[model samples]
Target chain A: MSKLSKKQKWLVAGLLAVALCFGISPVTGAMHIMEGYLPMGFCILWYVISIPFVVWGFIQLKKSIDANRRNMAIIAMCGAFIFIISSLKIPSVTGSCSHMTGTGLGALLFGPAAVSVLSVIVLLFQAILLAHGGLTTLGANTFSMGIAGPFLSFGIYMLGKKFNFNKKVTVFVACFLGDLFTYCVTALQLALAYPSELGGYSASFVKFLGVFAPTQIPLAIIEGILSVIVIIALESYAKPEMRSLGFIEQEA
Target chain B: MVIHWLWVLPFVLLLIGGLIYKAYRHRGEHHHHHGFGHKHGEATIAVDTYAYHSGIAHWNPAFKVVLSIVLLLFCVISDSVEVSLIIICFTTFVTVVLGDLSFHHYFEMLTIPLVFLIVGSVIILINFSWTPMTNVILCLPVFNFFVIITHDSLYVTVHLWARAFGALSAMYMMSLSTMSNEIFSVLRKAHVPALLIELMNMIYRNIFIMADTQNRMRNAAESRLGYVDYRTSLKSFGSTISNLFIVSLKRSGHLFDAMEARCYDGELLFLETEKPLNAKLILMALGVVAYCVLVWVMTRGV
Candidate 1:
C-alpha cells in the first residue's frame, strides 16, 4: 500500500541478490523449455516444488474472487496480458529470436502469486492448444517463467522504489532481470536433466548458459526497456485503475 | 570417420537459415496468438477453426484428449525410432483421415515441430568439450574446444528427434479435433479446479477483445507516423500496451457491472452443444491403443 522501510528494502535487495545468483536463467526452444526435454522424474520433482506455490496462489485467487466479483475478470485480463505479450515476437536480442515472458508488469501490479497462476495457465495453453510447451515439462517451465521470474521482478520493483530509484529505470531493471533470471532457472533445469558427463553439473550448466547468452542477454535488456515503457504508459492511461490495484499509491 | 555425422549438417544449415530469417524479420511478423500470419500460435486458432469443421467434431472432446494422451504415452515410453515413426504415421492418419484435416495444411503445420526436433536433437547429439574427443565420427574445432559427434550419439539423436516429433503430432491431433471451449468444458467436467477453469474461459474470450483493442491502438498510432523509427516504434508499442492494460481493467469493471445487471452471480455459464459418443470413433481410438501396445510389444528391446 505504501513504500517500504529501509530495513525492508535491504531484506528485499538481499533476497533478490541471492535469487539472482542462484535461481538463474532460461533458454529458448519456443517460449519455454519444451516438452519431452526433461525426464519424467525431473518433471515430477519440479511439479512437486510448484504445487505449494500454485496452492498458495490458488488460495489468493479464491480470496480475490470472494472479495469482489470484478476481481475474477481483472485476473483473467491479466492472463490475456501474459498470453499476448509472451506470444508476441519482440525485438531480437543477440542473434537468437525469443519472446518476452510478460511476467514483470503483472508481478509488479498483481504480485508474484497472481503472476504464478497466470504464467502456468499461459504455459498450459501454449503446450496444449499451441503445441509450444509440453504437458510433462509444465512444472519446470512454470518454475522458471512463472515463479522465478516474477519473484525477481517483484523484488526488483520493491527494492528500486525503496532506494528512491526512478520509476522508469526501476521498471526496466525489474523486467530485464526478470527475463534474465527466468532463463537462468531454465538453463539450470536443462543442465540438471542432461548433465555433462565429463564436467558434471557445473560444466553442463555453463554450456547451457553460454548457448543462451547471445540471445537471452539481449532479450532481457529489451524486455526491461519495453516493460519500462509499458509501466509508464499505464501510469498515465490507467492511473485510476492502477492506483486501485495498488500498483500506484493513493494520491497525497 | 563415421558417415552418420553428415546427417546433422543439412539440418544445421537449415537452422542457421531460420535464425537469420528470424533475426532479420523484426516487425512483429507473426506468431502463435497475436500476429496476422504468425507462425507459432497458429495451433490455437487453427485447432479452434478446424474443430468446427472437423468431420469428427462431434466426437467427445475428452475422449480425444485421452486418446491423444495415450498415443503420446506410447511415443514417450518407446526408445525405438521405428515405434516413434509408427506413432507419427498413425497420428497423421487419425488427424487427416478421421479428424478431417487437410493434408497440405497438416504438413505445413508439421514443419515447426519437425524443425524444432531436428535442431534440438542436433545440439543434444553434439558434445562440446575442452579436450579433443576420441572415437568421434567428425569433430570441429570451436574457439577453444571441439564439437564431437559419434555414431551412438547420432543414433540416440535420431531416436530422440523421432520421439519428440511423434509426441507433438499426437498432441496436434487432439488440438486439431477439439475446440478450446470444448476443452474447457471437459476440464470443468473433470473437476479440474473451478476457479482456474472460470478464469481461463474469461481470459480466452477476452484475448480477442484485447487483441482488437491493441490493433486499434497500433493502427491509430501508425496512421500518425508513430512507428516511423526505432524510438518511435518503441514509444508507440509502449503506449499501446499501457493503454490496453488500462482499457482492459476499466472494461472488466464495466463488464462486472453489466453482468450483475443481468443477475450474473460470478459463475458464467454457457451451452456446450454436447455430442453423444460415437461408437466408430471410440473403436478407432481403441484401435490406436492396440496399435501402440503392439508397437511396444514388438520393439521391447530396440
Candidate 2:
C-alpha cells in the first residue's frame, strides 16, 4: 500500500517549503537565551523534575542495546561521531558561527530513541568541554531539540506515508517540519523560562516566532533539499549497502 | 512592598535541602553499585529499559496529553513574574524531591546559572541608577549580614536573581526528565498532525550527522598543521566550514535517495505503544488543574 498519494506529495512539499520559509532565513537564531534569565527557583524545580524522565530514557536505551548489541555498538559509535562533528564550527553571516548538530541524521538512521541517547552524550560533552549549554539545563535542551526534533520528523514521515506521496516530497516535508518544530518548541521553552524579559506570553511568543522564522525556515528548507538529494544519491549508488544497514527496505 | 527576609529564607532552605537530598541519594546509589565494578554488561541495558517501561507504564498517556495542553495554557495566561516564579520554583522542588536525584547533582547543575546570575546582576546594577530609598535599603548593614540582603539595590538584585534562576531551573528539569519521543507521543495522542512530527524527526537525525562530518573535517585540517597560526586558523576554519556544508548537502541527498528506494511516500511508520487512561492519571491531571486554578485565584487581582 502506497503511503502517500500524488496530491499528498504536493501538499507535503508545500508544507515543507512553508516551514523552511519561517525557520532559517534570519539572524534571530543567534539569540540563544541562557539559563537564569527567568526565575531561578523555577529553573531548579524543572531540572529536578526532569531527572526521572531522563533516567527512564537512559533505561530504555540500555534495554535496546542489550537486545541488539550490534545496534548498541552502532549507536555508541554514532554518538561519538556526533560529538566529533558538532565540535566543528560553521560561520554564519555574523562574525560568530554555529556548528552543525547531526541530530537530524541520527534520527533518520536509528529513529528517535537512538538519536536521544546520542544527543545526551553530545550534550554532556558539549557542556563539559565547550560550555555551550549548562549541565543543569541539559535535560531541557535534550528534551527540546534532542527528543522533540526526531519524533516530529518521524511523525511527519509517517503521516506522509499514509497519503502515498512521492518519496522525494515526503523526505522534503519531513525534514522541513522537523526543523520548524524544533525551533518552535525551543521558542516555547525560552518563553517559559524568560517570559518577562521576553515580553510576556503573547509578545514574547510572537517575537520568538518571528525571530527564528527567517533563519530556521530557510535552514529547514536547505535541510530538506539536502536530505532529498542525499537519499536520491544513495538510492541509485548505495542501495545495497543502505539496505544492509536497514536504512531502506527492499521492495518485495 | 517591604521584603521580609524570613519569608525568603524558607524558600531558600527548601531549595537547598532539595539539592542536598538529590546529591546524597545519587552518591549512595553509586556507592551501592561500586562493589559490582560498574557492570558494563547487557544487564545495565535491561535495567534501563525496565526503568523506562515501568516509569512510563505508570502514567496515563491521556493525562500527559491534557497536562501538556494545560501547561501551555498556564504559560500563556500567567504573566505575573511573582506568580511565574512561584510556579517554577514549586514545580522544580517537587520534581527534584520526587525524582530521587541527589543534592550534589542538583547543586552541580545550579553552578552555571548561579555564576551567570551573579555576573548579570552586577552588570545590571552597575548600569542602572537607583533611588535614594532603594540605595539606603540596599546598603543596610544588617542586610549584608545575611548573605547581602538589603532593601533597595540588594533587594532588587536578589529578587531578580531568584526569579531568573527559578524560571530556568524549572524549565530545565521538565525538559531533562521528559523524553523527546514522549513529547511527540503525547502530541500524537493529542491528535497533532503527523507531517509536523515527521519533519521534526528528520531534522533531529541530520543535526548529528552534519555535526559529525564537520568535526572530522576540522580534525583532519588540524592534524595537517592547518591551524598553527591565527590567520591560518581562520582561513582553514572558513574552508572547513564551507566544505562541511557541501558535505552535509551531499549526505542529505544520499539520505533522500535511500528513503525514496524504500518506498518512502512522505510518511514514516511509528509503532504505537498501548497507553490507557486510568484513575491515577486522572488524579494527577486534577491535581495540576487544581494548583493552576489556585494560582489563578490568588493572583487574580495582581
Candidate 3:
C-alpha cells in the first residue's frame, strides 16, 4: 500500500463521515429486490430455482385441501395473517419502524412449504396492491422470504425440539435467524447481479450486507421476541384452536 | 476528472432529502403522547382503491396485463437509456392520463419503489480497491483498502436506475388500471392451477376482514396505553397479532360453517364481469410494441 498524502487523508475523512451518516440513517424502504433491479438472466435463474419449491408447496396444499373441506379457508386465513403482519409497524430503535417479514411465524405454524405458497400470493398482493415490491422481482423475493428463510426457520425449530430446548427460546432463535437469513439471501442475490469491478462478487456481497444487515439486526431480535410472545399468548388463550390448526398435537 | 464526480451529487442530495422527508413524516405521524392513531391503515388500502376506481378498469384485464408485461420486458432487456426514458414517460402517461389516476397518487406510489432503487443503484456505484487508481472520482481509505466511486460505476448506477424506474412505471400502469380480482379471474381463465386461484380468491377475501380487525385491536391497545414505551409496545403488538391469529382461526371456522350451510363444494366460483377485448385495445397494444421496437432499434449502440 502506498502512503496516504495530505489530500488523500482529507478525502478519506470526508468519505468516512458520509458513510457514517448513511450507516446510522433509518431505513425507509421495505426489503425487496425492486422491479428491474436484477438482470434478465438472474431474474430467470431465480424463478427457475424458486418454482420447484413453490410447486411442492402447491402439491402439499392440494393434498390438505383435498383432505378436508375447511382447508382452503384455513390456508387463506394464514395468508391473510401474513399480509397483516407485514403491514404492522414493528417499532425499531431508530425511531422509524420496519415491517416484519412475517414468514418465520407462518413457517413455525404451518411449516415451510405451506408458507411458500401463501407467501407468493402475499408477495403478488404487495407488488400490485402496495407497489412496495414488483412483478419481475417476485421470484427472487419469494426465494428469500418465502423459501429460504422459512425452510431454515422450520429446520431450526425442529432442531430446537430435538435438542430439548426451551420452547420460547426455540421460537425466538428460529424467528430471529429466519429474519436475518432473509436479508443475507437478499444481499447475496443483489451482489450476484451487480458485482463490483474492483473486488468482484464477494466484495459486492459484503457491501450489500453492510447496507442492509445492520438495520435488519434489531428488527430480527424484535421479531424473535414478538414471535415468542405470540406463541406464549396462543398457548395460553387458544390452545384448542392451536391444536385444531395442527400446530400443537391433539391429546389422546 | 473531479468534475465528473459531481454527477453523483444530485443522487446523494435526493437520497438525503428522501431520508429527511421520511423521518419528518414519520415523526409527524407518530405522536408519542397520542400513542396510537397513525396513517398505516390508509397506506395498505390506497393502491387497491385507486385500481378499483381507475378510469379504464372495465377494460379487458388480460390485455392490460399483456401490454404491461411486454413493455416491462422491453425495458429490462433493452438496457438503453433512451428506451428506458421513453417507456417511463409512456407508462406514466397511460397511468395518470388515460387511466385517470391522480398524478399525486401515482407519484407517491412511484417513490416507494424508488427508495430501494436509489439505495441499490448507489451501492453499485461504489467500488472497493486495494490500491489507488488513476480514475478515482472520490476515494476513502479504510485500513489499506480504498473505497472509491469510479466513472464506470457511476454510469452503471444511472443506467440501472433508469431501467428500474421504467419497468416500475409499466407495472404501476397495469396495477393502477386492473383490479387484482380481475387479474385472478384472468389467470383462472388462462388455466393457472385451479387450486392456486381458489386460494388467491379466498386470501383476497380474508385480507380486508383481518386488516379491519387489526386496526380495531391496535386502537384498543392504544386506548389502554399499551404502546407507551418500547417494551410495552412489543408486548402489545405480540398480543395483538396473537389475537388476530386466534380471530382468523375462529373466523375461518365460521366461514366454513357458512359455506357448508350453502351446500358448498371445495371450489369457489366467482362471478366476473365479462369485458370483451376490442379492436382498439389490440391496436393500442400493437402500437406500444411497435414503439418499443422503434426505440430499441434507434438506441442500439447508445
State each candidate's clash count.
11, 132, 0
Q: Which lDDT tens digits does candidate 2 get at residues B1-302?
A: 22423323444577678777767766645443212111112222222232243324335444543453355335334544444454554555644665443334445445544554554354223211122223233321221121122344354465566545544554444443444455557767667545445544554455456555655777799999987775576566545543554455456556766776778765666676666678775786576557656655665552
How high is the TM-score of chain B in model 2?
A: 0.63
Model 2 C-alpha lDDT per residue in residues A22-117, reported as the tens digit of each score: 333212322223433434344455556555555666666667645753343244445654554444333344323333445565566656766775
TM-score: the better of candidates 2 and 3: 3
Best by TM-score: 3
- Structural similarity to truth (TM-score) of each candidate: 0.85, 0.46, 0.88
TM-scores for chain B, listed for all candidates: 0.81, 0.63, 0.83
Question: iRMS of each prediction in angstroms?
Answer: 11.7, 17.5, 2.7
- lDDT rank order: 3, 1, 2
The regions of model 3 sitting more than 4 angstroms off are A1-29, B1-38, B140-145
Q: Write the per-residue lDDT of candidate 1 for residues A93-138, one digit (tens) a residue.
A: 2233457888877799899998898888888888876666788789
Which segments of candidate 2 are over 4 A away from where they belong? Answer: A1-30, A34-252, B1-90, B93-97, B100-163, B188-194, B292-302
Two-way DockQ contest, 1 vs 2, winner: 1
Model 2 chain B poorest ten-residue lDDT run: B140-149
Better of 1 and 3 by TM-score: 3
Candidate 1, residues B46-91, lDDT tens digits: the string is: 6567777887788878898888888777677665566666667677
What is residue A26's positional error in candidate 2, in angstroms?
Answer: 21
Candidates' DockQ values?
Answer: 0.25, 0.05, 0.56
Best by lDDT: 3
Per-candidate local distance difference test: 0.74, 0.52, 0.81
